[model samples]
Target: MIKSTQQSDNERWDGEGGSQIAELAKSLAIEELEEADRRILAFLGASVLCLWDELPDDARQKVLNRELVQSSFDASVVRARIALLFK
Candidate 1:
């Protein structure tokens, strides 16, 4: 049925996206980190995640409002940067 086909397509797309994210994470990981550096990176990553998780509802709403105001200009600049890189 059409529904089953759509579900399978979605699952395939999700799998591909997940693999791409995993590959990016692998590429971003520090290749030659010392134990101390690795511990520092882990601590920083955990702290960032915790800080994000602890953001207040009003702060999040403000961020969303600011993003909405800036997104179009930001996106246009990003597109221009990408275009320059390709040129």
Candidate 2:
């Protein structure tokens, strides 16, 4: 019973994370892509997703956490540049 519960929890987490990733990818496609680029980007995104899924859970978590930090830093840098331009 406990094992079944753990499996369900993992499935729920995976489903939620997958949906979030898909939504973000779709939003990026809408915002920045031309129609011609969409197919190529979608193919690349699928390939990356497959690779991501093959990673061990711990490795995937580490990579994602590091990416979050890097993304935060990048956003801050961009914001600072924009502020400088305005000033």
Best by lDDT: 2
lDDT of 1 by residue, 1-87 (tens): 999999999889677564544454465425455565555556755765578668887765553353353444343454454457557
RMSD of 2: 10.4
Candidate 2 least-lDDT 10 residues: 24-33
Instruction: Estimate every model's Cα lDDT from 0 to 1.
Output: 0.56, 0.57
Query: What is the TM-score of candidate 2?
Result: 0.38
- List candidate 2 segments past 4 Å from native: 1-16, 26-32, 53-87
The lDDT of model 2 is 0.57
Candidate 1 regions off by >4 Å? 1-21, 53-87
Q: Could you tell me the lDDT of residue 36 within candidate 1? A: 54
Residues 1-87, candidate 2, lDDT per residue (tens digit)?
Answer: 999999999889777675565444444324344554455545655776789878789877764453463445443454454457557
User: How many backbone clashes can be found in candidate 2?
Assistant: 0
